[model samples]
Target: MGQFLQSFIFVLIVIILGCSKHATAAQFKGYEVKSSSTAEFNESVVRFIESQKEFLILFSKHSAFYRFPKKQSIDIQIRDFLEARSKTAVKVRVKYNPMTAEIQKIEDLKN
Candidate 1:
Protein backbone atom coordinates (compact mmCIF):
# COMPACT_ATOMS: atom_id res chain seq x y z
CA MET A 1 0.00 0.00 0.00
CA GLY A 2 2.76 2.45 0.94
CA GLN A 3 4.70 1.71 -2.23
CA PHE A 4 1.64 2.24 -4.32
CA LEU A 5 0.96 5.57 -2.63
CA GLN A 6 4.52 6.75 -3.28
CA SER A 7 4.27 5.80 -6.92
CA PHE A 8 0.99 7.65 -7.26
CA ILE A 9 2.49 10.85 -5.80
CA PHE A 10 5.46 10.66 -8.14
CA VAL A 11 3.21 10.26 -11.12
CA LEU A 12 1.12 13.19 -9.98
CA ILE A 13 4.18 15.40 -9.75
CA VAL A 14 5.38 14.38 -13.18
CA ILE A 15 1.99 15.07 -14.69
CA ILE A 16 1.83 18.51 -13.08
CA LEU A 17 5.28 19.45 -14.28
CA GLY A 18 4.52 18.28 -17.79
CA CYS A 19 1.30 20.22 -17.92
CA SER A 20 3.03 23.42 -16.76
CA LYS A 21 5.66 23.19 -19.47
CA HIS A 22 3.05 22.69 -22.17
CA ALA A 23 1.13 25.66 -20.90
CA THR A 24 4.19 27.86 -20.97
CA ALA A 25 5.12 26.84 -24.48
CA ALA A 26 1.60 27.45 -25.71
CA GLN A 27 1.31 30.80 -23.95
CA PHE A 28 4.55 31.89 -25.54
CA LYS A 29 4.12 29.85 -28.71
CA GLY A 30 4.06 32.88 -30.99
CA TYR A 31 6.32 35.94 -30.87
CA GLU A 32 6.64 35.92 -27.06
CA VAL A 33 7.01 39.67 -27.23
CA LYS A 34 8.29 41.57 -24.24
CA SER A 35 7.25 44.94 -22.87
CA SER A 36 7.33 48.05 -25.11
CA SER A 37 7.68 47.88 -28.92
CA THR A 38 11.37 48.52 -28.71
CA ALA A 39 11.37 45.78 -26.14
CA GLU A 40 8.93 43.52 -28.00
CA PHE A 41 10.67 42.96 -31.35
CA ASN A 42 14.12 43.12 -29.85
CA GLU A 43 13.26 40.67 -27.14
CA SER A 44 13.18 37.87 -29.68
CA VAL A 45 15.52 37.82 -32.71
CA VAL A 46 14.93 40.73 -35.11
CA ARG A 47 15.54 40.50 -38.85
CA PHE A 48 14.53 42.86 -41.63
CA ILE A 49 12.45 41.95 -44.69
CA GLU A 50 13.50 44.82 -46.98
CA SER A 51 14.72 47.61 -44.71
CA GLN A 52 13.13 50.15 -47.06
CA LYS A 53 13.47 53.88 -46.56
CA GLU A 54 9.73 54.43 -46.47
CA PHE A 55 8.96 51.62 -44.05
CA LEU A 56 10.48 48.79 -42.06
CA ILE A 57 9.59 45.14 -42.12
CA LEU A 58 10.99 43.01 -39.33
CA PHE A 59 10.35 39.69 -37.67
CA SER A 60 11.92 37.10 -35.45
CA LYS A 61 11.64 33.40 -34.75
CA HIS A 62 8.97 34.01 -32.15
CA SER A 63 7.18 36.80 -33.97
CA ALA A 64 5.31 37.54 -37.19
CA PHE A 65 6.67 39.91 -39.86
CA TYR A 66 5.00 43.27 -39.51
CA ARG A 67 5.41 46.49 -41.45
CA PHE A 68 6.06 49.65 -39.55
CA PRO A 69 6.09 53.26 -40.67
CA LYS A 70 9.46 54.87 -40.07
CA LYS A 71 10.29 58.43 -39.18
CA GLN A 72 13.39 60.12 -40.59
CA SER A 73 15.24 59.90 -37.29
CA ILE A 74 14.53 56.20 -36.85
CA ASP A 75 14.96 55.50 -40.55
CA ILE A 76 18.55 56.68 -40.61
CA GLN A 77 19.41 54.88 -37.43
CA ILE A 78 17.78 51.59 -38.46
CA ARG A 79 19.19 51.74 -41.98
CA ASP A 80 22.70 52.32 -40.71
CA PHE A 81 22.37 49.62 -38.10
CA LEU A 82 20.89 47.12 -40.53
CA GLU A 83 23.62 47.90 -43.04
CA ALA A 84 26.27 46.96 -40.54
CA ARG A 85 24.55 43.82 -39.30
CA SER A 86 22.79 42.82 -42.48
CA LYS A 87 25.45 40.41 -43.52
CA THR A 88 26.18 39.18 -40.03
CA ALA A 89 22.47 38.61 -39.20
CA VAL A 90 23.03 39.73 -35.66
CA LYS A 91 20.22 39.52 -33.15
CA VAL A 92 18.72 42.85 -32.08
CA ARG A 93 16.25 44.21 -29.58
CA VAL A 94 13.20 46.11 -30.91
CA LYS A 95 10.37 48.07 -29.33
CA TYR A 96 7.02 48.81 -30.94
CA ASN A 97 3.33 48.90 -30.32
CA PRO A 98 1.87 45.41 -30.39
CA MET A 99 -1.53 46.90 -31.13
CA THR A 100 -0.47 49.10 -34.04
CA ALA A 101 2.82 47.43 -34.87
CA GLU A 102 4.22 50.95 -35.07
CA ILE A 103 7.87 51.27 -34.27
CA GLN A 104 8.90 53.50 -31.44
CA LYS A 105 12.62 52.88 -31.06
CA ILE A 106 15.45 50.65 -32.24
CA GLU A 107 18.63 49.78 -30.44
CA ASP A 108 21.61 47.49 -30.63
CA LEU A 109 21.09 44.05 -29.18
CA LYS A 110 22.38 44.02 -25.64
CA ASN A 111 25.18 41.62 -25.02
Candidate 2:
Protein backbone atom coordinates (compact mmCIF):
# COMPACT_ATOMS: atom_id res chain seq x y z
CA MET A 1 0.00 0.00 0.00
CA GLY A 2 2.80 2.43 0.84
CA GLN A 3 4.67 1.69 -2.37
CA PHE A 4 1.55 2.16 -4.46
CA LEU A 5 0.75 5.51 -2.84
CA GLN A 6 4.28 6.70 -3.43
CA SER A 7 4.08 5.75 -7.10
CA PHE A 8 0.82 7.59 -7.54
CA ILE A 9 2.20 10.74 -5.90
CA PHE A 10 5.27 10.62 -8.09
CA VAL A 11 3.16 10.36 -11.21
CA LEU A 12 1.03 13.28 -10.08
CA ILE A 13 4.08 15.39 -9.49
CA VAL A 14 5.46 14.53 -12.91
CA ILE A 15 2.20 15.44 -14.56
CA ILE A 16 2.03 18.76 -12.80
CA LEU A 17 5.59 19.67 -13.70
CA GLY A 18 5.20 18.58 -17.28
CA CYS A 19 2.03 20.60 -17.83
CA SER A 20 3.30 23.75 -16.19
CA LYS A 21 4.09 26.73 -18.43
CA HIS A 22 6.30 29.67 -17.56
CA ALA A 23 6.73 29.81 -13.82
CA THR A 24 5.59 33.41 -13.86
CA ALA A 25 3.92 35.78 -16.29
CA ALA A 26 6.29 38.20 -17.99
CA GLN A 27 5.70 41.66 -16.68
CA PHE A 28 7.75 44.71 -17.62
CA LYS A 29 6.74 48.18 -16.61
CA GLY A 30 8.48 50.26 -19.23
CA TYR A 31 7.58 52.37 -22.24
CA GLU A 32 6.55 50.70 -25.44
CA VAL A 33 7.90 51.39 -28.95
CA LYS A 34 4.68 51.75 -30.91
CA SER A 35 5.96 54.23 -33.47
CA SER A 36 9.69 53.96 -33.53
CA SER A 37 11.81 52.91 -36.49
CA THR A 38 14.18 51.17 -34.14
CA ALA A 39 17.57 49.72 -35.02
CA GLU A 40 18.09 46.33 -36.68
CA PHE A 41 20.88 43.86 -36.22
CA ASN A 42 21.80 40.25 -36.89
CA GLU A 43 23.60 38.59 -34.02
CA SER A 44 23.83 35.32 -32.13
CA VAL A 45 23.09 34.45 -28.54
CA VAL A 46 25.89 32.86 -26.60
CA ARG A 47 23.76 32.43 -23.50
CA PHE A 48 20.17 32.43 -22.35
CA ILE A 49 18.85 33.49 -18.96
CA GLU A 50 15.33 32.30 -18.22
CA SER A 51 14.75 35.17 -15.78
CA GLN A 52 14.64 37.51 -18.78
CA LYS A 53 12.79 36.78 -22.04
CA GLU A 54 13.66 38.31 -25.45
CA PHE A 55 15.77 37.60 -28.54
CA LEU A 56 17.22 38.15 -32.06
CA ILE A 57 19.56 35.51 -33.36
CA LEU A 58 22.38 34.73 -35.88
CA PHE A 59 24.59 32.44 -33.92
CA SER A 60 26.61 30.35 -36.24
CA LYS A 61 29.30 28.20 -34.62
CA HIS A 62 31.27 31.39 -34.02
CA SER A 63 32.71 32.37 -30.71
CA ALA A 64 31.91 36.06 -31.21
CA PHE A 65 28.31 36.39 -30.09
CA TYR A 66 26.29 39.28 -28.69
CA ARG A 67 26.14 40.28 -25.04
CA PHE A 68 22.64 40.03 -23.58
CA PRO A 69 19.85 39.06 -21.17
CA LYS A 70 18.26 42.30 -20.10
CA LYS A 71 15.13 42.05 -17.99
CA GLN A 72 12.55 43.17 -20.55
CA SER A 73 9.21 41.97 -21.81
CA ILE A 74 8.75 40.25 -25.13
CA ASP A 75 5.58 40.04 -27.16
CA ILE A 76 3.77 36.83 -28.04
CA GLN A 77 5.21 36.76 -31.54
CA ILE A 78 8.78 36.93 -30.30
CA ARG A 79 8.06 34.24 -27.73
CA ASP A 80 6.57 31.98 -30.37
CA PHE A 81 9.55 32.51 -32.65
CA LEU A 82 11.94 31.55 -29.91
CA GLU A 83 9.89 28.49 -29.01
CA ALA A 84 9.77 27.31 -32.62
CA ARG A 85 13.47 27.83 -33.07
CA SER A 86 14.31 26.13 -29.81
CA LYS A 87 15.15 22.93 -31.67
CA THR A 88 17.66 24.54 -34.02
CA ALA A 89 19.98 27.50 -33.95
CA VAL A 90 19.34 30.04 -36.71
CA LYS A 91 20.06 33.62 -37.62
CA VAL A 92 17.59 36.44 -37.08
CA ARG A 93 17.27 40.15 -37.59
CA VAL A 94 15.90 42.09 -34.65
CA LYS A 95 14.28 45.48 -34.55
CA TYR A 96 14.95 47.06 -31.20
CA ASN A 97 14.88 50.34 -29.41
CA PRO A 98 18.37 51.78 -29.14
CA MET A 99 17.48 53.95 -26.21
CA THR A 100 15.89 51.20 -24.15
CA ALA A 101 17.67 48.22 -25.72
CA GLU A 102 14.39 46.35 -25.85
CA ILE A 103 13.74 44.02 -28.76
CA GLN A 104 10.59 45.02 -30.59
CA LYS A 105 10.62 42.64 -33.53
CA ILE A 106 12.45 39.59 -34.80
CA GLU A 107 12.47 37.66 -38.07
CA ASP A 108 14.50 34.83 -39.49
CA LEU A 109 17.11 35.84 -42.05
CA LYS A 110 17.56 33.88 -45.27
CA ASN A 111 20.89 32.20 -45.70
Candidate 3:
Protein backbone atom coordinates (compact mmCIF):
# COMPACT_ATOMS: atom_id res chain seq x y z
CA MET A 1 0.00 0.00 0.00
CA GLY A 2 2.83 2.42 0.87
CA GLN A 3 4.53 1.76 -2.47
CA PHE A 4 1.30 2.40 -4.29
CA LEU A 5 0.84 5.68 -2.43
CA GLN A 6 4.39 6.76 -3.28
CA SER A 7 3.81 5.96 -6.93
CA PHE A 8 0.59 7.98 -6.93
CA ILE A 9 2.33 11.00 -5.39
CA PHE A 10 5.07 10.81 -7.97
CA VAL A 11 2.53 10.72 -10.74
CA LEU A 12 0.79 13.77 -9.29
CA ILE A 13 4.07 15.67 -9.21
CA VAL A 14 4.79 14.76 -12.82
CA ILE A 15 1.36 15.90 -13.87
CA ILE A 16 1.79 19.25 -12.10
CA LEU A 17 5.12 19.87 -13.80
CA GLY A 18 3.74 18.93 -17.16
CA CYS A 19 0.86 21.36 -16.77
CA SER A 20 3.20 24.15 -15.75
CA LYS A 21 5.29 23.59 -18.84
CA HIS A 22 2.26 23.74 -21.05
CA ALA A 23 1.18 27.00 -19.45
CA THR A 24 4.56 28.56 -20.10
CA ALA A 25 4.51 27.34 -23.68
CA ALA A 26 1.13 28.93 -24.23
CA GLN A 27 2.35 32.19 -22.73
CA PHE A 28 5.29 32.29 -25.14
CA LYS A 29 3.07 31.84 -28.18
CA GLY A 30 1.99 35.50 -28.15
CA TYR A 31 3.50 38.09 -30.54
CA GLU A 32 6.14 40.66 -29.60
CA VAL A 33 7.30 43.75 -31.56
CA LYS A 34 10.79 44.79 -32.42
CA SER A 35 11.76 48.16 -33.95
CA SER A 36 14.17 48.27 -36.90
CA SER A 37 14.14 52.00 -37.63
CA THR A 38 17.03 54.27 -36.80
CA ALA A 39 14.99 56.22 -34.28
CA GLU A 40 16.96 56.55 -31.11
CA PHE A 41 15.36 54.87 -28.10
CA ASN A 42 16.04 51.99 -25.78
CA GLU A 43 17.46 49.20 -27.90
CA SER A 44 15.51 46.51 -26.12
CA VAL A 45 12.20 48.29 -26.58
CA VAL A 46 13.00 48.93 -30.23
CA ARG A 47 13.76 45.28 -30.72
CA PHE A 48 10.51 44.24 -29.10
CA ILE A 49 8.42 46.61 -31.20
CA GLU A 50 10.12 45.65 -34.45
CA SER A 51 9.53 42.00 -33.74
CA GLN A 52 5.74 42.40 -33.46
CA LYS A 53 4.89 44.51 -36.53
CA GLU A 54 1.69 42.66 -37.38
CA PHE A 55 0.21 43.22 -33.94
CA LEU A 56 1.43 46.82 -33.92
CA ILE A 57 -0.30 47.65 -37.21
CA LEU A 58 -3.57 46.24 -35.94
CA PHE A 59 -3.20 47.98 -32.61
CA SER A 60 -2.40 51.33 -34.20
CA LYS A 61 -5.28 51.16 -36.63
CA HIS A 62 -7.90 50.11 -34.09
CA SER A 63 -6.82 51.65 -30.80
CA ALA A 64 -6.42 55.33 -30.17
CA PHE A 65 -3.51 54.67 -27.90
CA TYR A 66 -1.43 51.60 -27.14
CA ARG A 67 0.52 51.42 -23.93
CA PHE A 68 3.47 49.40 -22.78
CA PRO A 69 3.18 48.67 -19.09
CA LYS A 70 5.87 49.98 -16.77
CA LYS A 71 8.20 47.02 -16.63
CA GLN A 72 11.57 48.48 -17.62
CA SER A 73 13.39 51.80 -17.68
CA ILE A 74 12.94 52.28 -21.40
CA ASP A 75 9.59 51.30 -22.92
CA ILE A 76 8.86 52.27 -26.51
CA GLN A 77 5.85 51.92 -28.78
CA ILE A 78 6.00 52.27 -32.53
CA ARG A 79 3.21 53.66 -34.69
CA ASP A 80 3.28 52.41 -38.27
CA PHE A 81 1.40 52.90 -41.49
CA LEU A 82 1.88 52.39 -45.19
CA GLU A 83 3.78 54.76 -47.42
CA ALA A 84 3.54 55.45 -51.16
CA ARG A 85 6.04 52.70 -51.82
CA SER A 86 3.79 50.18 -50.16
CA LYS A 87 6.38 49.84 -47.47
CA THR A 88 5.61 50.04 -43.80
CA ALA A 89 6.32 53.50 -42.44
CA VAL A 90 6.56 54.03 -38.70
CA LYS A 91 6.58 56.93 -36.30
CA VAL A 92 7.48 56.55 -32.66
CA ARG A 93 6.02 58.57 -29.80
CA VAL A 94 7.41 58.07 -26.35
CA LYS A 95 6.22 58.76 -22.79
CA TYR A 96 8.61 58.57 -19.89
CA ASN A 97 8.24 58.97 -16.17
CA PRO A 98 10.47 61.72 -14.88
CA MET A 99 11.16 60.24 -11.48
CA THR A 100 12.15 56.82 -12.74
CA ALA A 101 13.11 57.87 -16.27
CA GLU A 102 11.24 54.81 -17.40
CA ILE A 103 9.15 54.67 -20.55
CA GLN A 104 5.49 54.28 -19.60
CA LYS A 105 3.68 54.39 -22.94
CA ILE A 106 4.16 54.65 -26.68
CA GLU A 107 1.58 55.90 -29.17
CA ASP A 108 1.42 55.26 -32.90
CA LEU A 109 -0.30 57.74 -35.15
CA LYS A 110 -2.73 56.90 -37.94
CA ASN A 111 -2.31 57.90 -41.56
TM-score winner: 1
Clash counts for the predictions, in order: 9, 1, 14
Candidate 1 off by > 4 Å: 1-39, 43-53
TM-score between model 3 and native? 0.28
Q: Which segments of model 2 are wrong by more than 4 Å?
A: 1-32, 35-37, 52-80, 83-89
* Candidate 2 lDDT over residue span 1-111, tens digit each: 999999999999988865443321112222334636577677543343333443433344534333233343544434444554554555566556666655564455652
Using lDDT, rank the candidates from best to worst: 1, 2, 3
List model 3 lDDT by residue over 14-82, tens digit each.
999878654443232122334333222321122223233222222232222223332222222122111
Q: Would you give me the overall lDDT of model 2?
A: 0.48
Q: Any idea what lDDT model 3 has?
A: 0.35
Give the range where candidate 2 is weakest over 10 consecutive residues by summed lDDT.
Answer: 21-30
- Residue 41 displacement (Å), model 1: 4.0
Question: Which candidate, 1 or 3, would have the higher TM-score against the true structure?
Answer: 1
Q: How many backbone clashes does candidate 2 have?
A: 1
lDDT of 1 by residue, 59-89 (tens): 5565555554555644444455555444556
Worst 10 residues of 1 by lDDT: 24-33
Top model by lDDT, which number? 1
User: Model 3, clash count?
Assistant: 14
